[model samples]
Target: MDFIARATAIVGGTMVLLRRMSAPAAQAVGLTPTIPEAKKQGIMTLKMPTAKGWEPGHKPTAAQGLKVNAFASGLAHPRWIEVLPNGDVLVAEALQTERPPTSLMDRVMQATMKRAKAIGVSANRISLWRDPDGDGVAEVRKVFLEGQNQPFGMALVGDTFYVGNTDGIVAFPYEKGATKLTGPGRKLVDFKPGGHWTRSLIVSPDGTKIYAGVGSLSNIGDSGMEAEEGRAAIWELDLATEKARIFASGLRNAVGTAWEPVTGQLWTVVNERDGLGDETPPDYLTSVQDGGFYGWPYCYWGKTVDDRVEQDAELVARAITPDYALGGHTASLGLCWMPEGTLPGFGDGMVIGQHGSWNRSTLSGYKLIFVPFVDGRPSGAPRDILWGFLSEDEKVSYGRPVGVTIGPDGKSLLMADDVGDVIWRVTGA
Candidate 1:
């Protein structure tokens, strides 16, 4: 290994030891998770499982009465999924753009991500999949759109397909039965890129507006809050006029978004800030209110002040507490609403794809989970819908789940496994 790689490996090993000696193995999770006192670390926990793609005949473990199969394989870092009106599936393949390490932490993160097989040239395209026979496996695959700027989220509203590129929301004229889009698209809104780069898009239920999740440019606004303007919030774009405004503010890295069917409220999964010990603040699933603030760079988990950042007593007081915690550093990034009986024993709830964590000592959220809901609020504890992403020893990862959506058949679940380069379909066994 090179000097930086060797240094990173040594540092990572030391952090693992320090973590074991300092804190308990259990991490806080669920709606009423125990929030431990923040234990700041000089180097912070940096334990990431080495990426090992699934072997032949290997697959994730599905919940009881359910089975999983590869809906499509041989993808290139597929991170997001969208189902079209014509029963077609669209998968967005992209990865983070490598930036030069500016600090020791940056160098460690870069090296660690490389070790985890996360650093690579983005595929920068969306592929279309078709399962005409309803056999779960997609026999037809085509490049629907190429040369996107690290696209993540996708939506189609009345012939205009919207894609949330890292730097902007782009719109293209999409026909109902067309297999590919060949026209140059127009930019709907520009977003500041880098830092947390995945832009998740969801259209309003009434189809009048589009909401885009824009994450912070830095953790805790370390680069100065001024650099974080127009970020760390969801932006709403009115289709009538080509204008956009911040819908909700202070979400650290609000990613996947979905609308609740019962109450028609917008819900999102947020990845909280790091370096605050194993369980100071938890990543959350919450109903996003318009003009509401949830607190970032000022407070977290409702008015629990994070003293590390510059204090804003007024903003902190107004900070709204998130509804549910998904565990600290779980990296909950994908959200979708599942109606009752979407899966055999699963009731109506939100399905979340936790991309898993690299910041905690013991890993958290390397699987797909379901949070049962009643009326419109989270009612019960989360249950694993699919797991076994990590090896028994937890040092090797076979796959990482990102985006999730109901399958075209409306009876199954489709999830994107980026590291494994496959789309998995889940249904009744």
Candidate 2:
């Protein structure tokens, strides 16, 4: 093996054998989950599984009484899915650009990423897929928007379609049932580019505003606080005034957002910081409160202080606890919640796409989970609705799911698998 790959494997394997020092992943989930004390790491665990695309006739295993099929395939790193009002699906084809190798750690991480098949040029385009006959497969495909800057999130408000690129949010004019966007979009807001690059966008229930989730530039302001301005928070943008302001702060990486139907509240799934063992702090799904702060660099889970960050007792004191713990390093990203009748047996819950883990000795995610809700709040144990993203040996991955959305028909769930470059459709049997 090459030096970097071998080195990472040796370290990761050693940690697996020494996992007694870490908390089990199952202990860090659900509404009243445990948060074990942090174990500071000089070098975080590097356990990225090799990406192996699925063979012909292979697909992710669905839950009992559910069927899985590829809605569309051969997509270039499909990362997010948005279903239009007319049953059209929009898939974002985005890839992360390799950062310049300026430091030894940077070079090492880049090499590890290459071995895991993660280093790729961004396609920077969105495509529209249509299954006109109610078939699972999309028979009609077209490039909806091209020449974007690693776009991820997409939203449609009235006649305007908005896309959240890595550097900004842009708006495009749209016609009903149109497949292509011919004109350039106007920039709504600019974002500072760094570590957490995906910007998740969601329109308000009343359609008066747009909320954009911007992640931190560094894990814990390591790139400096100035570099993190206008990041690690959700920004509310007024549609009428074209003005924006920070909606909530101290979110490390809120990658998905949805409006709760019963309460009309905004909820998001956030990926937390790393380097504190495998299960110190958990990723979470929480209701977004305006002007609220959840601790990031200073603390977590509402006052479990992080010593690595200089003491900020005041800010830590004000940190709000997240609504649900998604387990440490799960990389929970895509979130979609529907009313009780949408999917049978998975009633009134949020469907989350966990993108899996790279920093844990043993993987924690790599599956889709359903968090049942009681009166707009998460309750009960999360149900595993989809699995088989990783190979049986657990050393190779068939795919990693990102964005998920309920189909326009309201009976299907669409998932974007970046590693497999396919859009998966899940439906009741």
Compute the lDDT for candidate 1.
0.91
For all predicted structures, in order, the TM-scores are: 0.98, 0.97
Evaluated with TM-score, which candidate comes out highest? 1
Cα lDDT tens digits for candidate 1, 240-339: 9989999999999999999998899999999999988877788999999999999997999999888888899999989998999898888998899999
Residue-level lDDT tens digits of model 2 in 1-429: 269777878877787657645547454998888787788878778788888989999999999988899999999999998888888999999887897877777777887777776776889999999998888899999999999999999999999999999998899999998999977799989998757889888999889999999999888888777788899999998999989999999999999999998888999999999999788799999999999999987889888898888777889989999999999999999999966766666789899999999887778899998999998888899998889999866799899989999987888899999998999999898
The CA lDDT of each predicted structure is 0.91, 0.88
Candidate 2 lDDT (Cα, 0 to 1): 0.88
Q: For candidate 2, give the lDDT of residue 44.
A: 75
Candidate 1, superposed: residue stretches over 4 Å from native: 1-3
Pairs with steric clashes in candidate 1: none
Report clash pairs, candidate 2.
Answer: none
